[model samples]
Target chain A: MKLSLSSSPHQRVKRDTGQVMRMVIYAMIPGMIAQSLFFGWGMLIQSVIAVISALVFEGLILYLRNRPIERTLTDYSAVLTGLLIAISIPPTLPWWMTVTGVFFAIAVAKQVYGGLGFNIFNPAMIAYVVLLISFPAAMSLWLPPTTHAGITPSFFDSFSLIFTGFTTSGYDVTQLKTIADGVTMATPLDTLKTGLTQGVTYSESLTKPIFDGGFFEAAGAGWGIVSIAYLLGGLYLWKTRIISWHIPGGMLISVFVCASLLHLVNADYYASPLFHLFNGAVMVGAFFIATDPVSASTTPKGRIIFGAAIGFWIVIIRTFGGYPDAVAFAVIIMNMAVPLIDYYTRPRVYGKNADKGRGKY
Target chain B: MTDFRDLSLQGLWKNNPALVQLLGLCPLLAVTATFINGLGLGLATMLVLIGSNVTVSLVRNLVRNEIRIPVFVMIIAAFVTIIQLIMNAFTYELYLALGIFIPLIVTNCAIIGRAEAFASKNGPLASAYDGLMMGLGFTAVLVILGGMREILGAGTLLAGADRLFGPIAENWTVVLFSTENPFLLAVLPPGAFLGMGLLIAIKNIIDAKIAAQQTVTTEKAARVRVTAES
Candidate 1:
């Protein structure tokens, strides 16, 4: 005699945490490569430092918490968190800073909140905000893209600068940021904001040598290629069905709409939609950071609301607020509202019409 | 003896005004930004608690039940106003620093809680004792929170000691580390909430450990009794 167990649905989605985390890690490769290619290979060193510290911290925390260390290590969530933080930070960030950030991300942000799925905020973003707030100068230290900086940090120089704060030839990280005109180049968004604040028009700001690029003009120096790479990775995640399209689609469209409206109203005051979309962390934030399943709105309609609000916040904060780029602030602020969004945007019961969710008769 | 011990224990740990009872959180969180600020506010609160407790207990028998709360509140307000005036006269710097909080201490739930719960029922001596212990307990938490926020936020301990102690204290500030970057987040209001949370978590851990030890000792006693019976 044979016994059989059958169900209506015969297929199952691949629901392994380790596998999903591995996919995310795999997806970030193109973006990381693009960042290295443009910014310098210091991103590579930061990633390595972060990953090592993250694994050690994760393992140590798991040991202290009396959990299975081997099982948790296999999950690769720590690696992914470290990777995200590494990419989000300035590549020339000190090695110790990387260690500190990863420790906060893994031990405080992730493990303290009871690990991966239970974390209330995006662990990477929390550490990013902490570092940005605590060490503003170091956090804003972005190198000019290699094409503009006229001198890229070789692997050894990048290595020495990251670990020892100076290169082989005794050049400092700040020196690496200088161009031929003796000006320490700033990020495109920062340049634009500073210029506009100084009463320069949008076109006048773009004329700065920092904005000189063949294909990267729409984006900042290295940031344009980096953003494109992140967009590609994000699209890959969408294609593989690893992530849903609602978040990035809603975020990008809303950003475009908001920027277009403000730009139309006052061309000199607001940057164009294209500028807002391509510059700084907007591309990466919409596609990668805001789409974290645990912290983001889970409901379909809620996701749209969450994404659109973040987009609106990014634009509002960037144009009028003190900060130049506001992706981290916008994401964290919207994360606090995810619960409210999800509660209101709940899907109706199977037998009930969607009107029930809206409290309509 | 047991009554005083129990009252002291309740004030210090079991029904702690700051940690356990969670009373007077307004001042507990607000003035705890620095050790001196916390210490000053704490002393002021303690003095008011003792004053109100003693006065309320002495007048408890004469007051009507319905009118007692208003009377207790009035007593607390009077003590707070006197303390405010004394602080303004003597520690003028601290008075300015802790401006609204001193007056606001009149509304501190800890003072009225004692007046309503303990002072109204007990003798003046026990009420005074309760007030002292509760005040000390509250002061300890504020100092701890303040010290923690001070150290983490600014990498200093007992900073601004001159504000509370006097001219000699101007040089009493303890420096643990120095940095140019403003650890501004830790000095902000959010730091108060974080510090309070950590303090509460620590209190809970101590509570759980005490409970566990008590259970183990009682089990040992029971086992000894069983063995003796056998």
Candidate 2:
């Protein structure tokens, strides 16, 4: 084969920050579509509100900081962050809350910490945590997926509910939470947590209607499909080399291992591995959120350890902690550990002692 | 010895314990949830500062250098107890509201810092003035932070004023607005931190502006008659 003269990096992919960010946004479309289909149109509405507000806030902050607003905004990182936030929050969250969350994500969480790559914690997760803490009542008001709910809000209804806190047909999110069977429904993780707290066995809790008639037996209705879509999108990213497999791979394996070990010890108290994998934010979190390059572990080995730790915390917190979903909390906690992980897991240099190497390596 | 004017200026503006020196942050952050709570704690802290400063200055000559720290702490503890007892008697609700922080005033670094740095080398009158001015500075910050948090978190100012003042101040709460959900983050401990950071930033900005103005004037003054006017 004929060789062309080039230094070091012989193979190059024609991709910049804007391209990578666009790819990530493209990858998230599947998850967004699934979310909107399963939940009402509220997810789409919330996403639009979040993305617009995120761009506005990001631009404002950039302008105030005397940086190039157009170039940074074009990178689409803010859009992805806003989308991730919209996915994580309850679809029926009020519009103003979505705006406020986006503002905090862009301005305080991202810009205040020196913007984009310099942010220590993932801005989306920080905004999610802040919104979760600040508005617990509104944040928890999730509706049953359209499959179970008797009345699915139309696009107009979703828009109306977000803007005015009531649907066009005069139904509030709480009222819309009622399923066809006249029982108000929470998410599967929430249902399981509440059941476990009330001394109901895990197996008995699985028999709840939220879990009984789902498409997947292990994961509940709509959520399992949504998770599967995210997994497919994640697989695409993996195939395209947009993300490495270590972080997601380690996170999934560790989650399965932890849940299985606990489930094996006592089937009645603990949920199975599949439930842990396909429910909550595990699929999305492991693939998309935990793989955030800025706040995640940099070295390959460190990435694995970081992912595994987050996985363990997810299972632990979801099972024992007060919160039903653990992904946002888990990701934020792991982000704090990334620098330490990267520092200790630095790769050894060639022609140098691995143990003693400190300077460039 | 420093003049009263210089001492007052240093204590109040130049060398603020809460903002500049960053001393006694534990009480500054913890008890400043409302204006009344902050005011109550600030007053108690000021009393301890004054009492300890006066006492430490009086005994500065007798106490050996090796044992001065212990002596200063003991004096501060005594004053803290005195303030605690007084608050318990007159403002029992406020005392209960403050709880452990009243006794914790003894641990406030600003008190012992003044004792060791200022009172030990200064006359009683100067030390007393320093204490009063420093106390006022610390109290001003507490009041500002507390008021900011209260207005943001609860949409009211001087809420529960009766806790600090007598029952006659029951209606002192000025409601700025009412909402179903006030910003809960502002009431939390993290809010205290963010508010404190903002206050520090504001102070720095003001200082920078003053420095810039002074430089411009000095530059004008330093302009010599290099070229005699044509």
Give me the candidate number with maximum TM-score: 2
Off by over 4 Å in 2: A1-6, A354-361, B225-230
Alpha carbon lDDT of residue A269, candidate 2?
A: 92
Across residues A1-361, which tens digit of lDDT does each residue of candidate 1 receive? Answer: 8987788676778669888778878888898888888888899989989999999999999999898999999888888888889888998988877887787789877888898788878888888887887678888888888888867889999999988889898988777777446887889888888888899988778778777773656565667777888899989888988889888889999999999999999888788898899888888898788999889999999999999999999999999988788998999999999999999999977877767668866
Interface RMSD of each: 1.3, 0.9
Model 1, C-alpha of B24: deviation from truth (Å) = 2.7
Task: Give the residue spans of candidate 1 off by over 4 A.
Answer: A1-8, A168-180, A214-218, A352-361, B223-230
Question: Model 2 chain B — which ten-residue stretch has the worst lDDT?
Answer: B221-230
Candidate 1 on B15-60: residue-level lDDT in tens? 9999989999999998898999999999999999999999999999
lDDT of 2 by residue, A1-361 (tens): 9977879887789899889988988888898899999898888888888999999999999998999999999999999999999999998888888888888788888998999899999999988988888888888888888877888889899999999989887988878887467897899998999999999999998888888667677699889999999999999999999999999999999999999999999999999999999998999998899999899999999999999999999999988899889999999999999989999999977766755646654
TM-score to true structure, per model? 0.92, 0.95
